[model samples]
Target chain A: MTAISGWGRYPINDTEMIHPRTVDAARRATVQANPGIARGNGRAYGDAAVGVRQTIEMAHLNRMRAFDPRTGQLTVEAGLLLTDLIATFLPRGFFPYVVPGTSFITVGGAIAADVHGKNHHCQGGFGQYVENILLVLPTGETIGASREEHPDLFRATIGGMGLTGTILEATIRLRPIETGWIRQRTFVADDLDTTIGALECGDSATYSVAWIDCLARGARLGRSLIFLGEHAALHHLGERHVANRFPLRKPSMSMPVDAPSFVLNRWTAAAFNELYFRAGARKAASSTLVPTHPYFFPLDALGNWNRMYGRRGFVEHQSVLPIKNAQTTLAEMLDRIAKRGESAFLAVLKKLGAGSGSLSFPMPGYTLALDFPIERGLFSVLDELDELVVAAGGRLYLAKDARQSRATFEAGYSDLSFFSEVRRTVDPAGKLKSRLAERLLI
Target chain B: MAAAEKAVLILGGTSDIGRATALAFAQSQWTVRLAGRSLADLQREADDISVRTGRQVTAHPFDVLDTDSFTVFVNALPDLPDVVISVVGLLGEQPRAETDLDHAKEILRTNYEGPALILRVFAEQFLGRGYGSIVGVSSVAGDRGRGSNYFYGSAKAGFSAFLSGLRNRLAINSSIQVMTVKPGFVRTKMAEHRKLPPLITATPAEVGEAILGGLNRRRDVIYVRSIWFFVMLIIRLMPERIFKRLKL
Candidate 1:
């Protein structure tokens, strides 16, 4: 009765039902509907989250089913969110293996994407920590898959994007922590060269990230700010663990509503970027835990911040070029964005290590991702960026791009045929489909 | 208990968040289908999701602008999904929306009319079947309409309120769960070329975890990052005259 979305931020149609609640109920709903798509907190900026006729809401399927403190294993229902997991485990001296940019994603979603984080250089991705999963097949049959048990299904499922089956629950390994804080170091780079030099230096970090501004032209083309961190040792927090343990706090007020346009533009963005670049006064020292939320992901603190981009919405252009062509590849990409006069403020550069996931996006390359508010000529800008990515033998991160040509996608991934071959084993009917699927021609 | 070989749907698909959510489900071995309007882009997203998630992910033609076939779309799926996540959002031109009636209507329709209509159907099926969960990506924007983006924020406010009500409604008689998730700024393809404030900006994965937390506790409302609660609270409590005068 309340309807589906809070704000009509997305273009949605009527004539459909969006279901929300428990797991058994999800099973029952599956039995009745001809087909349905599972929904999490609707944060995905593209159509992968849309439901045509039947949409199942997993926001309430959140439940920590089981946890073994000794081994630091957690069994959570399909809809459990990552933020809640950290709130529960961090004080317990444990955490999820890999995390993405925001905390609004679900456990089912994380497993579905096999998300990677800052530490991915050493830890691989999130899938490595997943012990097993309880799955529901298309025939409405339920099964359990893991590294040892349904090996093929397990591997395919990690990055399959929910086409293989529905995830009922996830069993994952949690990490051990000393204090609820981190020891962090910051490095300021005068150019891209210094940033690259710093990454090659050492791995004595639990986390490392570089912030680059794609807008800087000429002399300071790829100027950067690098930060590295590790968890504070056991003696750091002393006895604060018991007192701060659940950190019971009220949920933040959601975005009251969408904002007016005209708030975001090149001029506004430039001024902000200028201040941001100057604000990162660098230093290295032991830091406070400060609740893993903002530290791990600083952007999650504000709500509906994207509304500033006006009504046309925005898009992020993230491309990872092989390390072999790092300088040339990035230079070209930057040239394209700059020439188009579409430079975003928050451009990041990460020197990737070996990526081990089946369909992982980050490889042994330099990954640069930036957000650009949509405007006239933006599509063409993306088109040009895509071309640059292809020429460098690099690929666009499909997870981030809502507009990608089929040809570009095919060219981006050389082994496109191999994934389809594996998909046939799980879903031969091609029944499970999404808006993203139709575009890619898969 | 084993998870059923599932079919999942994301309403308001075509968003970076929605696509990522679909990818999340797909990688978990769930057969995922991303339904959206632009056939060209959606298909590639689906294929990419398929490769990324390793589930037999596909794309089905969908038009959120068309309100006539929500039921048909749901009925057409090969199988039912265990859950549904709606990351559908439209932060249309706030200036245009505030000044132009049509733009305001578009905002309301995209966030409210469309999602409500589709979700109502989903609710009926989920309730009748006695199962399912609805996770709606409400926003921190919905907390309190501020000076900058109140139009979009109000719609999200309605959405968040609706989700809260849905959660309360499903609490008693149904196994269905409703989660309202609020995320701050996400650095996505759509948000390229913008100056995002540092303290509250989040990446896709951080939001992914917050959504996970809401689901874990079956919480009615989830703030992706805990700090957002304080940020919004201070903003909300401020007097309107003073609030309007502050420079964001």
Candidate 2:
């Protein structure tokens, strides 16, 4: 047994890890004495990928099975990393329809979390692009599930957190692109209403996101800069852009050690926020054409950036509310956070389109994500925020959740009973379980 | 038409190192044929490589213990392979083989007789064609016998000697090449239960790439991690008077 933790580096657990190189080996591992969960790159931010007893490291099972260039349909083993896909296909004028903030995640992890990206307003969640999934059930039987067949099990497994079974493989539809550059434009907002208004009016762009200054107060409350982008067409590219297309530059910088806890106090956070906001304001000029790496995955440039939160690590609170209550709910949460003198180092907000799947996190509204270091009274504050979110009919993203009450989870997801019914039918004895499932009473 | 794709034949295709080596060769545009005990066990890897690299990969039935079928196996291939790799090895229960004669014999045959016979068959074919490369996966355990697993070690030692002599004989014509790969503490299914030292352990992919590099350079002998070369040299040079007293 070895100690393993998710990307957040919190709640570490000693797990018996097995790396299966083939599908048959993975199936045999599921029937082992200890029940386990499938873990892919351990990027789910919490205990969702770490089981108490065992963890099947699916990285070795990565393999490409089939790909049709005409229709842009790709069949790949569930362990294939998104980074590998982009490195192999982006140069060939293809990209995943939806991609999360980090390319380190695997196909299985993406489906289990139903992760949404900056383009959620146009492409929806990652699960929306999946056409079919092959699952290895607890009974050691491999079955295919899709929208047309076994729809209930398919829906339940999309965001089921590996409680249903081990995802063996999946078929996803990739979107075609002329080049690997993004035409980007930035808009600065001084307050909450302006930020929300800018995001709502920027529907013409395919990809949209906002970086908020959670430490700002009074007239500067909810100060943010919204970025909108569309794929750069082939005709728009100049000689230099076309000559150096599809450059996948590796991260040049990384945090070698954990920073001291005192380094990220409210004063430091507020100063950084001021500098960022001013920089954005200065850049509000003619649109710029940026490479895909910096445009979509800005944080990825600094590997292990989470270590800056200190030894206690941090928790990401990401929640979505209906369009009608999104503005008020977000404002209330931000106001409460600021009043308590607590500020997050990074804050992101994005608009989402209609959600799919029974337990998918996205809905037709705005979602706000904030990262707060673990400290005294942090849980109580998050608990109060959870109540506010529940009252506004918003649910937390389970992928980023390390702590949330069972009652809150049950109350937030209205289709819990249906998901439970499908899960029970598929895994009656519950051979596949994770710590997060136990915490949420799934 | 473009020159016919060069081909590589991999024995024991289900082994972790074999599959990784096959994929590496396929990525280099080589048509791969994976042979193991059962086609079903090899089908997944063959299909995966075919799709990922757009290369032709096929599965065939081959049992290393069935020495009589070696000639037929080579004859049945669609096209003569430009390179052949033998990754057949078995680490049976060391403690059990210590007392059980049958278990010891099985280990000896799996590590020595079976692989040696198969390579001999391929060596003859390559001699007639006047071109080809033969890679035999040996082990550092063969350098000096240890009390822990001498039965398996002795068999590997015999295989290593056979490869050395084969290299000497085949290099006379300078058309066919024979290379011996010595891998130390690879992280494969066979080594899952063993507690390996972290500094010396190498992944199967690492070993696979080393094999390809060794073949391309036509080396007489290559160690996967390179550090194992010195580690084995010290062990082999140890005086027997003191070496026999130690339990390692």
User: Which candidate has the top score in TM-score?
Assistant: 2
TM-score of 1: 0.61
Please write out the lDDT profile of model 1 over residues A68-153, one tens digit for every residue.
77888777777888887776666567778788877778888777666778887777778888999887776667779998998777
Q: What are the interface RMSDs of all the models?
A: 13.9, 1.6
DockQ of each candidate relative to the true complex = 0.02, 0.53
**RMSD to truth, every model:** 18.0, 2.6
In model 2, the clashing pairs are none
List ranges where model 2 is wrong by over 4 Å.
Answer: A1-5, A12-21, A28-36, A52-54, A249-256, B1-4, B193-202
Give a tens-digit lDDT track for model 2, residues B4-70.
3688999988899998899788877788999999786688788778877778899989999999998
Docking class of 2: medium
Which candidate leads the pack in lDDT?
A: 2
Candidate 2, residues A351-431, lDDT tens digits: the string is 998777788888888899988888899889999999989999988988888998998888889888999898888777777
DockQ of 1: 0.02
Candidate 2 has a TM-score of 0.93
A31, model 2: CA deviation in Å? 4.9
> Which regions of candidate 1 are displaced past 4 Å?
A1-17, A28-36, A237-254, A282-290, B1-248
The lDDT for every candidate, in the order shown, is 0.69, 0.88
